[model samples]
Target: MNLKLIKGMRIVAATHNPGKVPEIAALLGEDYEILTAGQLNLPEPDETETTFTGNAMLKARHAAEQSGEVALADDSGMSVAVLDGAPGIFSARWAGPGKDFAVAMKKVEDRLEEIGATDRAAWFTSALAVAWPGGPCVVVEGVVHGRLTFPPRGDRGFGYDPIFIPEGGALTFGEMEPAAKEAISHRTRAFAKLRAALID
Candidate 1:
């Protein structure tokens, strides 16, 4: 996205998720000042788009327009191979209005049982977008393949972390230390792509 070309030191993180800000900041490092939509009380725009890249771009564009600065946004979710990505974009909605991830996790388990599906293959996908006020935008996507675990596990991460076991890893994301998970996270991979674009 040629972040260096952007004429500013401050950029808005176009998200309200409490868990996402710190992770994104850590990934972006200290080169730019990071501010969030919540900090500025920016109203969240409706995520009417259907794809990760579409949603991420929607949020980034909204934030940049509102804040008059560059903005970054991400849309991420878990896609089950058997479910044919049932909750791909609906991952958040699966948590229902209360946003109770516990309930959502159970729903996934129940569905698997109902279908008698034994293949637990799944993947976490993240699409990141950066946009400037009334100008250019760039989007990138990254994924981490994994399998689902029933009854969930651990208590370290938010969302579906407790149920996902990364490829070649014995521990679920919720079971890993924050730094450990960050090292191979889907978000981390996506951020690497974004960072490369900026630095290149």
Candidate 2:
């Protein structure tokens, strides 16, 4: 079966994270009806995979199989160059069971301090995957280079946004308006490929 998203299709978003819900819906735009695994009461699957694409594919497929519909999932994280990508796949876990990004951000900052890292070069990586029930999936990844900022700033976006300043940008993702952030977000960059392959 050809897996494609129609103009008014209903599909599971394969995520339970509140912050990710709106972001995914916004990134996918209004053409499609986006439902969440949480909304459907589908249990969030364990992300056992080590890579973004691997985890994304697992989530998407599980959601698709359970929901009996097309499913899309995103696995993303921030990696510090100096930290040797310390929090790469464990981004969410870094936030702990409470999922408090504030604590997670502090952990990152403390790690940087521990190493006396002067170069704050960092990057955000996003993996987007779409799967059809009992069918194959398509996955794509996008990355945006940037550096870390101290003390965090703003409160617009979620997760590690406040501490990350995208390359060639003055404001952190948290400081930028939703539309502004979307214009240069790792999710947007990643979804562009999915749009080309399945939507458009």
Candidate 3:
């Protein structure tokens, strides 16, 4: 689905993660100019929120206030049901302090096994927030259901993608092609909703 924003409307994507920048740019379409918080040297506030929406808003607000432009931010993570929804907001830092997704995935697997959870039903959640300076802010969410697999597979994607297999798929997200994965990823679902809201 293609959507167009007003020309000359610069939007800041409030993320320092290189992984997210291009995806946001692609989702926002060509009419809107996309900028990164790192490029603008925008300060990142501590994400003390307990929910993805709150964290997304916090980052988007920071970017909007700093750049004096509308900002879009997304917070996403994997939630394992057997683990009691652990590693939710802390998905990025689950591996102690750094953004070590491999370690985080191992920890998740260990925790699940510790509980003897054979029916590992889980879901990936993504929340996209857009803040327009002092103007209104909007938050949209989307989820993709899946189950966990032993011994992470493939070398594509980041985070728990290597271990999580989406429903009706043979390969884990890490094993799927980028275009194939993007078609049904949690972030893509959320961004699709956000695009509809913003453009229509």
**Which candidate tops lDDT?**
2
* Residue clash pairs of candidate 1: none
lDDT at position 95, candidate 1 = 99
Worst 10 residues of 3 by lDDT: 1-10
Task: Compare candidates 2 and 3 on lDDT and give the better one.
Answer: 2
Worst 10 residues of 2 by lDDT: 17-26
Per-candidate TM vs. native?
Answer: 0.94, 0.94, 0.93
Off by over 4 Å in 1: 1-8
TM-score of 3: 0.93
Tens digits of per-residue lDDT for model 3, 83-192: 88888888888866777778999999889878878887889999999888776788999999999997999999888899999999989999999999999999889988
| Model with the higher lDDT, candidate 1 or 3 | 1
Query: Candidates' lDDT values, in order?
Result: 0.90, 0.90, 0.86
Whole-model lDDT, model 2 = 0.90
Clashing pairs in model 2?
none
Q: How accurate locally is residue 83 in candidate 2, as Cα lDDT from 0 to 100?
A: 88
